[model samples]
Target: MSTAHAYYPSAPMPITMPQKPGYYPTPAHHGYGRVSVSPPQAESVTTSGGASYEPSATSSSYAGSASEYDSSGTNTGVDLLDYMGDRLHGAFDPVPLDRSLAKQAQTSGELNAKHRELLELQALAQRRLAGARANFADGMRAAKEVQKDLQWTQKRVDALNERAARKYPAEYKSAQNRYPAPVDY
Candidate 1:
């Protein structure tokens, strides 16, 4: 079975008072400078018949304290260990090569000569490649321009043909009429 309650229609609703000033004071020694801490009050749940219910005080304080205290903890021994671990692991190891292998490597004079030769060859190849590429690009561009010019010339010839037909229709007709179709043998 369930029970239900109803409030009187004419009754005045309850009112809550304004919060107190300086309710939260800063801790002087912490050096964080004037941080306010206000504990949240437990809300009163009121039934329709004016029956008020409050949650447990201990439970309410726990929520507030959890939020307030949640932060990065101070640099402890574990932190120091982690930092030392990172520093040690992050460092690059010194590479050791065989002295005999190094001695067997190419001589400095020979290396310098080869390097110079390589540089000279690279420079010559670069110049030739650049010249070839430039020539190719220029040729392509010129071909495009020539194609455009030929199209323009064709357009001009067509215009001229149309103008000649309008201005000298008789001559135009005569020229077309004179050119007879050849009979295939």
Candidate 2:
């Protein structure tokens, strides 16, 4: 702004940032003292967006700091326009790539390859399922037939043992004494 229209006061106005919870800047760390123009009051203001804050000090009373400020109210130090235009230039330039992002990208690429392998395995399983089912069915039928024949032969051996025990007791008892049945079946 031109000198005539500039809102920049001769004395720097208290910089008021939005108040944050659990954080209050003291003069020691922030390097700026607090200013209150009038007696402290229980007052607050709400913005249009519904944020509430303590009002800025109004009117005029600087406590015992009257001698510290220039009574004449004149310009001091560098111009605001020059400081903003020149010194604040490089703050908005693009930042370099962060290392964490590179690591994340590498892990994501590896996971993608693993996911592709799993997809291929799923497809192979789908392709071979019909042939595998057919082979299993054939094997099942053969196993059942062999099991049935084995059961039939076992029943015949048991029946023969029962007949020999009843019809030829004398000889059967002698045979039993010499060699006992291998199994009850």
Candidate 3:
């Protein structure tokens, strides 16, 4: 088997794009885009007498009372000129506004939103820190208990050695000469 080291680029290569001209539809100053103000085209109809006549606007299906239109105040049935005329005749009122006050309110609202996010992150960090500290304390207590148990065991072993030396003095002295006491105990 061949041992080959694979190399990977740390960053991707930059892409080069050709510059081209782009077109966008022009937007109207008011209302929906590009309103058509042209009059409707008439369709010619031939009767049994072979005479052709164009249809009239009033003869169409929409020739009814003004109230027959939608009552939502939109006046979709009215002509564009008439609609604009009615609107200009004090049908709508302009409200006075202080732009500086509006800007200040918006900034304060954004500041409050950011402050809430900061507090949430701070609370999460505090909870994680508390958990880490508690875990560390529990580990330290466990290590201390293990050390205490080791000291108790070492004391018991020393006591057994003392008893053995007293009971058989001749053999104990020879064993002591071969292996000295451990320095830590």
The number of the candidate with the highest lDDT is: 3
Better candidate number, 2 or 3, judged by lDDT: 3
Give the Cα-based TM-score of candidate 1 against the true structure: 0.31
Candidate ordering by TM-score (highest first): 2, 3, 1
Candidate 2, superposed: residue stretches over 4 Å from native: 1-89, 92-95, 98-104, 122-140, 162-167, 182-185
What TM-score would candidate 3 get against the native? 0.36
lDDT of each: 0.54, 0.54, 0.55
| Collision count of model 3 | 0
Q: What would the per-residue lDDT of candidate 1 be over residues 91-182, giving only the tens digit for each residue?
A: 73434345545655646667889999999999999999999999999999999999999999989988998999899999999987898445
Model 2: per-residue Cα lDDT at residue 76: 26
lDDT string, candidate 3, 67-161, tens digits:
33322332132234433444464464544345667888999999999999999999999999999999999999999999999999989998999
lDDT digits (tens) for residues 1-95 of candidate 2: 11122222333333233333333333342223333222233223333443333324323333424543432322222233333434444454434
Model 3 pairs whose backbones collide: none
Which parts of model 1 have CA positions greater than 4 angstroms off? 1-119, 176-185
Give stretches of model 3 more than 4 Å off: 1-110
| CA error at residue 101 for candidate 2, angstroms | 5.6
